[model samples]
Target: MPLLAYWVTYASLDRAQTDWYLFWRARFRAGEPLPTDLSYIFLHVYETLHGVGFNRPEAAFAHLQRLWRSYRVDHPQLDHHLVDWLADFIRYYDLDDEVTRAWLDEAWVHAHGDLAVHYWLERGGGGEVPEGVFQHLISYRPEQNKFYRDAEDKAALDTLLRRAVVLTDSFYRETTGESVFERLKTKATHTVERRAFSGAVFEGPDFQYTVATIRQYRQDGRLSKLLTQAVRHAENLARKQVGFRSLLRDVKLPANLAAYLDVHLAPALATLQPPSPVQTPPAPERPRVQLDLGRLATLQQESEQVRGRLLEETEPGEASTDLEPSISPAVPATPALPAAPLAAVHRPPLPAQVAEGELTEVDSIAEVLAGITDAARDLLRQLRNQGWEAPEGDLRLPPGVFTSTLVDEVNEAAQPRLGDVLLQQQDGRLVAVDDYRNELAFLLGTPEPAALTPPLDGPWGALAGLLSPLHLEVLAQLLQTDLTLGELEVFTTARHALGSAVLEDLNSHALDTVGDILVDPYGDPLTLEDAYRDDVRRVLHASGLVHPE
Candidate 1:
């Protein structure tokens, strides 16, 4: 089902309105709340975060939080629950997982893109955005084509995108840079190819069996449209092979005879002498002529048999020997040894008071206003002192015309903190430069790296420092660590049941099964077909349809 319910709402409600619309709407809708729609949106939020497990968690949470905050201000009625959800987000954040990055890749990064806008209008806000306050909250992703965008509150979507890039880069470094793919192939292959080169294909199952399996998947909605297409292709290829076999069998030709005939038969036939028209010597032929009807019948029977076999031909153990063998991916019958319990990933079960934390709320708007103003002044001084740093070959930011890149770009209400920044640029210069650049810049008059210390702030700060938008993604990691360490029996039981190898095992499994299940694109962009596969998987997993495998 779609994330939001389809309501023929006012088409023009595209911006955040501070007016008491949510309050009145809540009263009007009352019991008939948009539960399914709300849940759908949450699931999308959840699914995207789950994909971040392929990357980072804290970063992911930071992004989600930004979105939650932006979308929830005018949605004050939902804020209480949403805030709780946000807290939970921090609780379950995992630093190394792709769940965090997944949210951005699938949603936030593209939130304001034109496509997101259209999606929101055509899909999301069947209801309109309220009419006031943070009206500009609605941004468009030209990337997705100009469409009405969705925003409940006002936070910077561009900021979320920048943070997402950093988180993605970090994930790439962790999962790909230092022998990740090699290790995955190495480890996954080692586990998968245990019965290596036993020369078995989808052992025991014949082609009919494979075809039957695919057909069943289609019937059960387990196979997506794309996968169905692939299955059809495979079927077509098999059928063609059968046709070829039948032609060869009936044509009474050598193994290569068909090709030879196709290539040379016509030319050779051209060289043949025309039929002689001379009167026949009839007497000699009439003497011994006898028709073998029985033999002809036997020959016809043989041809029919050949055709039947050809239609159901088998290629033996050719392809799929190593990929998904007939015997399950990992034999459930292996009688897995009761291994030590792995740690459980959890919502911060720590008492709310304890888990609640010291990252003081943005305190008050007054403090934010002062801090933002001071940061802006300090930033200007820093900019002037540092001078333009854009490379000459690159399209340059004109000298002295300070571009609001990172913290400087943020309004007086949202100055980035030390840890909140992953990276920042100044006139195309790295504002939050890395250690190497910090060292180089320090030597050449740059400032000290703010994040050189362990990330001291909350997940949001760490995200800014680290660069991510998923709210509390860092906290999620902390929670995951505790979860892994906690001798929780439930976590162990869950992992065993799901057969997971990662912290976000259930989330991963959700992706695994749901990732392949897609609604018909119904003539959408071909590239989106791939993205939709990813999206559906994430959504399904988040919704708990695809359990962890």
Candidate 2:
């Protein structure tokens, strides 16, 4: 299956690398070791970070994280070839595994502390670490390595390192205490020789020396360039394999026969073969034979009566007729079965069915909304009172509107139910979905509310109708974190428009739509730059399918 998928995506190198990664991931899961060739893993990591493999880099990070965790269970130490790439993966994804965190910390302390610390700092860890670890993070110097690259790259790197140092110090001081740096220094008094000043001297030629040299080359940032070359080589090999496999699948030939022809007959077939004239064989006369015509006629009549009797048994109401007495004729068509009843038609379950455990078919919108939680009901009231009006349809509300007024109120909204009631606009506005408007009015006891016939298309279809593709994607992302306007600006602009000017226009248009969605009916309208949260995510898991409470 992996090979077939690889063939389908043969043209794309990134996709091929992703396939190769998954192929190995399965092996790791089954307690098998990975291939010695590190090219496949490196390419997968690189492609995933760049968002080429697996469509989303986050997904790629997750896959690699699982693979690493599984592979490390039996192995005591990581492969030397994987350290740099693994470090890059960790930096890009900010992985949270405790084992990985400890491994990275130890690896940096014992291996290339100077080079790895930049990535560590840039990634920005969430939790606290030992004070000595911060000292190592801030104090390491790249220039200590004799094999370090020239001054041109060094200057830029040094500037970055200085910035990282300041950031780390500030962060620790703020999070810990004013005397944290001094405490770190006191803790580092014992291991000063091991971590701080150990690798300045050159070791003579040996297996360990060779390993150290290779590690230096990688730390100096040369391995990534070599990995790119390896990727091209692997891609070339993959293309040939895919081409051969495709030929085999399409030719409908046995594997051995195909191999035999390619090996022995291919050269011979290359040269044109002369056409040979066809030969005809003469016909020979046969001896005379005789049959009784009266006996054959009697036998044929008996056979027809037997077939007619069998047909009568199969079709009770229809009368069977005798077969025409001939050697060959066209066959008659069989009778069609009766159509199925309307009740047997496969119609989807109504909205009432989806809400069966928590809500009833006849429950009012106010009652359902209130049943979710007090926070949820309050969120709806805020939307109803403060939501902005769309140009042509219902009022809309952005997540930010709720977030600005009530602290953590967005977490209170049930996305499943909210998705039932709120329609998503292309610009990411949540307008009260029109499908439930009448149902809601009825639920709220509005006088003379128009009777609404529940949609027969089913609950899922109705839910799908409430949001566009982009809305669903954005909502899913929001379940993880509140998306900033700058991120949204980049995302919407890159995806929806072509030119920079048009992208800017679209960005502005999106902001305007957001304003309409979060109009704040009783106060000042909300801006796009304001922080927004997904209330549905508060009640739902990352899958966005199951409600946690």
Steric collisions counted per model: 67, 5
lDDT of model 2 at position 125: 33
Please, what are the lDDT tens digits per residue for candidate 1 over residues 208-291? 100000001112122122222222222222223223111101112223323322332233223323223447566754466788
Q: For candidate 2, write residues 98-124 as lDDT tens digits.
A: 756766665553233222333343346
Candidate 2 residues lying further than 4 Å off, grouped into runs, are 1-36, 50-82, 90-100, 113-549
Per-candidate local distance difference test: 0.30, 0.36
Minimum summed lDDT over a 10-residue window in model 2 is located at: 189-198
Once model 2 is optimally superposed onto the true structure by TM-score, how far is the C-alpha of residue 324 displaced, in angstroms?
A: 99
Worst lDDT window (10 residues) for model 1? 208-217
